[model samples]
Target: MSTFKQGRYSRYLKPFSYLVDLSIINGAIFFFEINITNTYLFSLYISALWIIISFKNDFYEVQRYTKIVQVMTLILRQIGFFALILYTFIGVFKQPNISRLALGEYLLLVFLLVAFFKFFIFYLLNRYRAAFGGNLRNVVVIGDTEKSRQLINLFKKRLDFGYKFRKQFIIENDDFSLQKCFSYIAENKIDEIYASIAELSNKQINKLIDFADNNLKELKFIPDNKDIYAKKLKYEYYEYIPIISLRDIPLQVPINKFLKRLFDILLSLAVIVFLLSWLTPLLAILIRLESKGPIFFKQTRNGFNYSEFDCYKFRSMTPNKDAHLNQATKGDQRITILGKFIRKTSIDELPQFFNVLFGDMSVVGPRPHMVRHTNLYAEKVDKFMVRHFVKPGITGLAQVSGFRGEVETDKDIINRVKYDIFYIENWSLLLDIKITVQTFINAVKGDDKAY
Candidate 1:
């Protein structure tokens, strides 16, 4: 069995940042040659004051998901406090003879150096995580819901954020017990636990809090509707209907949407030009030899906004009346030998590049379902409709994560919705490229679930 490795040194990063920030502060005093009567005494006062101000402002409490803009705001706030203290020191000690120009230069110099240091370290850490996959936190979600699953998805999609997802434990299930979850956390060395506030009882929540505190694990809660404003949930007004959001979705931003669309258009056009341009005709001839049907299979699948669109694929099954109603099962008699080959290699899905090009789909998103299946799952699944928030895709996170093909049971469909929701909640350009590359590798390796 594999063991979960937690990030042991992250606890030290905060103090290390403090040390560097203080050094930059005192070092600037001499570097800028600020004139003062007793430089050492003033340095001591400023250093102590800096620490107090930083604590009051929560300046050093940077989290993994803290944005660059937030850090800039922190820097500005810290500098303002520092300026106030400098003037106060002059007033208290009666040193008006000090060179005002020199003090101004000193303040300006410290601000520049500190801002550069903070930003440089921030950028470097992100790059290191992205390139080398280090500094990771082993996290587990304690409840299964839209908000918990959204956080789990964020952890998976944002590699640079440095969270390694372990598992999600459903509290609503009959077999679930706090003892089992506690044992898993201990054995797996989990670093964090995220529980949904709506799912846990008061007693269970208290137990979890005690367990996390005893084990030195971070505990966070997923806010419910009632606790949205109280818990600082993102609030937006949608035509007078107040809405609360759990996280900031990148695809919801205008620029991110444009960039993803541009990427889909370029990549779809390239595939249609280079691979599908020749392969489509050859597959057409072979498909004709095996069965008497249209060269391309077209069916209505749910697209963005619950809209129906004709999704195209190379015909892989024999002509049948149940084609639109039934999904292809393993060892189904309707599939031809060529169908099996094409489906395993994912050649049958190549024509959907045209769907992507036509703007009915994206290069990566939730895979659309047949119209009947969509209507059924929308009723049966918890967050199935959330998949319709973004354009459907030929291949998706679910497919690449081994949730593709025939649904053998309710668990299969449920897991598919989990990953689909995760993809929608945490869409990123890097994630799309990663899923696409993984899809190709799975195609070449032949997925057992492909049929």
Candidate 2:
């Protein structure tokens, strides 16, 4: 219906809705006019202003998948704009025809009436669509990606959104080409073309755009932010050049970032001042009693963005050349008596609180990978490197979820990467708090793979 009508019937709803709004406002003014005896002309002018404002803001644009909140916001913003213009006009011209209290009531009544009408029409429209109305637009999604798949699923789940998927063309599939894409659309009454812009080649994108334009089809592109972990993306023109802007990730939002960092610092400071301050000395004595090495072991590991940072831990093994290269096994004899006990109890990781204080790590995030392991896994696993997009932590969702310990199999690291990415994508204060509590619980209960 989008391509066939060019939004014909849907477009008419705008003028119709606007006309209803004018009638309500005029009626309100006519009833409430006590001091203002000649409100007919004033009502007409105000109605015109309302219509003009609604048109300017594209309030009547028919969007099948639009949320109800978006509709409410549009109406409220339009009213705000109208109120400002009306007040300025009256103030500057010194129009003393209106009764302030009556005029206020009139405006309030106008708002209420219009709001009721708009929502009532909205309910009718939703019901109309739900009955498999003819306004449904047939769309073909091109590209197999998280965004593309999600779009397809949303359309399927929401029949009231008035979208029907004709076909899905995956560029990476066994048989997919521009010719095949054209043929697929030719067979169906496709109204809109949705493509994953990042995955499509420039020539392919241009062809799709040109086809949509010539055929009067709507063309929409889904952005790729999985790699950059962009929470929000905005497309706008900067002078003549088109630009894509990446908004702040949830954790990096100004207030959230400040609070999270402040919390990390204070908690780390408290632990160092009280717990670690005394416990470190006792652990040092035990560590040094068995091994002829420093009590605290510091080794460089991959942190946020794969940056190397000195991760501190109590010495849990005899100093070895493969400190960062080799993974600690079940019982390889590199561990001393005291070292095994501390490693199992996870007391050896207490020194990393200083790393959190030093801003090298977070209290909760994907566990920092050894530098060698990071390079080794980056090439083998898909989206494995995405874990580096955030700060590494001493314990993480992956750790507490039992994806911890040595990566003995490919599946081990795969599951770990999945959880790590999930954490990165859905990070919140509550999520961090939950993970921290779980980590504490797991430490006390003891994980079999820890040693």
Candidate 3:
């Protein structure tokens, strides 16, 4: 299927999903005999919340690559949010007439009904597409060799990926003419085209762009070796190196990005006020007692768009610890006894709430690397600087997934970069919450690599 067609299908499906939710909500209210002065107002608010959260969660983006577990988890989160909103309103308003049993029954019925409708619709759509002659995307390849064949095999193996391979056109060298290629693409009604960038000439590149511009069809090219950086292409980490391809960032979507930032700001402020305010002073005194140095350590680190900013951390090492750059090793001499405990508990990173407040960082994102380390790793690791596309975070997907502490080996940095890229590509508010919850759990358990 062409990208345009697939997008149109998603648009069509969204309204049906909305109507289904509306029906379920209304049915639940009727079945539970819930009587309130502003019942429709309440229903509208709840239904709107579900739709907004669903969009933020990308629930309507069901595709061949969409995982069942991801969809189910999103549904659960949406339902949980609805429950929280409903209960909070009820409690605050002191609505004694609203029966507790009715509310419980209403929430339960809506949850089950909505889940069933969504799953059944998706299942039927998949079955119908398989059973009948459905609109399958016709894709063509520009290069006829190994890389092209590998891409073909991937699509064939994953039939649910919504791609239908049509044919391959071989372009031998940089001198290959694109005039013929454009003619062939137009005649074939190709929905999408993939080419190897290394094999294409300047003329051919321009032709492909012109073709996409004229035909309103999608044109994606695979890098010869994933070495080039293009903001237009989505990059995924294979350990430390990035696998670049034409894809959109999840965070770039307006609604999802907005909700994510809002969550970050609100959550960061709450932590700063309720938790970090008092804890910072106490930890500052402890650090001062242990070492004759500044209570807080400030260092220049890369933030969003590779912008440099001063990131704060509770001082965890003795005075005169090398500021240039050094990865703290196992039993490092510079790490004081008090430093070890705070680092293990991740308490040292709490001061970054100010970074969050100052808009230099997010509550969750790719962890920032030291300026020296960034310069070093960019040479050692391919696509190392891609993490700077987003603001650095105090805790990130990498940290939660056990990539924290000293990155002593090439492999360690690679793994961390991979997780960080994955986080950026698939970012959502729920993902941030999940990472935060996991970070808390990991802190309590205490990993050997923490200090």
Better of 1 and 3 by TM-score: 3
Which candidate order results from sorting by lDDT in descending order?
A: 1, 2, 3
TM match of model 3 to true structure: 0.50
Return the top candidate by TM-score: 2
Q: Give per-residue CA lDDT, model 2, range 1-451, as digits (tens).
A: 0122234347577658867877787777668754654456566678777766775666665356557887798778877787676665466556776567776776677778877898888877777877846578888989888777888887777777777777889899877897778767756767667788878898997777555533445576776653453445545321222224332246644345556777788878988999998998888887888879988888888776456889999999998988878888889688889988888888889889999999999888889878778777766776676676678988899998888888899999999999987888778888888888888788898889889
Cα shift from native, residue 355, model 3 (Å): 0.8
Residue-wise lDDT of candidate 1 within 46-79, one digit each (tens)? 9898887886677876656778888899999999
TM-score versus the correct structure, for each prediction:
0.50, 0.51, 0.50
Q: Rate the local accuracy (lDDT) of all candidates.
A: 0.81, 0.74, 0.74
Q: Which candidate model has the greater TM-score, 2 or 3? A: 2
Q: What value does the lDDT take at residue 319 in candidate 1?
A: 89
Q: Candidate 3, 391: how far from true, in Å?
A: 1.5
Off by over 4 Å in 2: 1-237, 240-248
10 residues in a row with least lDDT, candidate 3:
1-10
Candidates ranked by TM-score, best first?
2, 3, 1
Residue-level lDDT of model 3, residues 1-451, one tens digit each, is 1111122334467667778787787667777666666777777777777667777666666654456676688778878887887777676666678877788888898889888887887677655555563546678878765666778776666455566787777776565567666676667767777877778777877767655633445677766576456566665432232334454667756476667677778888998999998998898788888779899889988676556789998888886648647867898889899999988988888889888878888888988888788767765765565676567888899988878888888889999989988998888788899998988898898977898
